[model samples]
Target: MLMKANEPVGSGQTGLSDSEAASLYRLMTWLSPSFPVGAFSYSSGIEWAVEAGDIVDATSLRHWLASMLADGAGLCDGIFLAQTHRAASSGDDVLLAEVAELASAFATSRERHLETTAQGRAFIEIARAAWNSPPLDRLIAVCEVAIVYPVAVGLVSAAHATPLAPTVHAFLHAVVSNWISAGARLVPLGQTDSQRLLVELEPVVSATATRALKASLDDLGSATFRADLASMRHEAQYTRLFRS
Candidate 1:
């Protein structure tokens, strides 16, 4: 298994039924919206598109979020996490650079940039000040000054010795939930409707993981064009409620 020397023996090895209650608690704490990462700020282009009359009601918003999740953001961020996890695991510098460059280029709009990179930078700042894991701290130096989101998140999870699947799971789910939360406020969708929307988006993340596992490097720059355009428009909106 090659875990760190201090790694605690687990039921998985001894079958003594010691649950990973500590790790699970850590995952829950990281995924909570109260982590102070500003995850609730950016809408990932949904605010703009909805304001532009592109998404009107619950049905349309669900379909829109579904499409974005299935074919757009979810698949892309999953890839980032996969690569980031790999880099963090092997302590690969070149892989880390690729992760950052990919994140910088993956953005299609200012809002997307704000959404991912800004969050990335925040993740690094908070991590350095609080948890202060070596791999995460090393990433702050070796990597470019702009710390990408998934990379920082990956390092924290890896340092905490969290499983890749659940870490990725929490990250993807958080991303989708933020969009749905914003949509509820923006389109005035009922609270129940937003809850239903999150329930539906779960599979989108799973399907995205499937496709991400098979995706090629050539597919990196691709994104939904109208969605990007709407994001650009939202920046100059006469009345602004959201940053994006």
Candidate 2:
């Protein structure tokens, strides 16, 4: 198995281990909506898309999200999360901190900035209280800029020794799930349709994660320009169902 010089020696290897149950449980807990990241309150501009008739149904919602997961914030956040996990697992605080800062600075719009940082702060605060570790504590102490959600997820998962690939996969899945939930409400999609959409997106999520594993900061870029405009417009939306 070839490995990058900076990659953790045992990285990308996990499953059915003695700690498998614990690892799965942790990922589920952290990614679940109940984790208090306030994920439900932000749609990443999906609310505006719905308002603009850009996502009036399951098909449109899926189309928009497929692009998001493949090219937009999804790809960028995936790489950030992947790198942060590798750095944290390898005990490279400097690299972890660098990734954290970059992720925070990479937000393109005002709401996008708020969307990530708010969730990041909440994730860190709750994780610190419940899943505290020296590594996490050190990350908090040294991270001058507010951590972004992906970076925070990476740090927490890596510090817990959760495998990188699954962690990124679960985190991205959770992101899509949350967005779907928003669409279901905003697009008024039926519960069954939402579930179906999620099923369809499984392949996209897997492919995005696979790409992210080999990607770096240089790979961070977004092509979801309309969504970006929607996010900016959402800030001034007369009546809104979501924060972003």
lDDT of each: 0.74, 0.89
Best by lDDT: 2
Put down candidate 2 lDDT per residue, 61-166, tens digits, no spaces.
9999999999998889999999988887787778877888888888988999999999988998999899887777876666678899998898888778889989
Q: What lDDT tens digits, residue by residue, belong to model 1 across residues 105-153?
A: 7777777777777788777677678776776666556566465577677
Where in model 2 is the C-alpha error above 4 Å? 1-15
Backbone clashes under 3 angstroms, per model = 0, 0
lDDT score of residue 97 within candidate 1: 77
Per-residue lDDT of 181 in model 1: 88
Q: Would you give me the overall lDDT of model 2?
A: 0.89
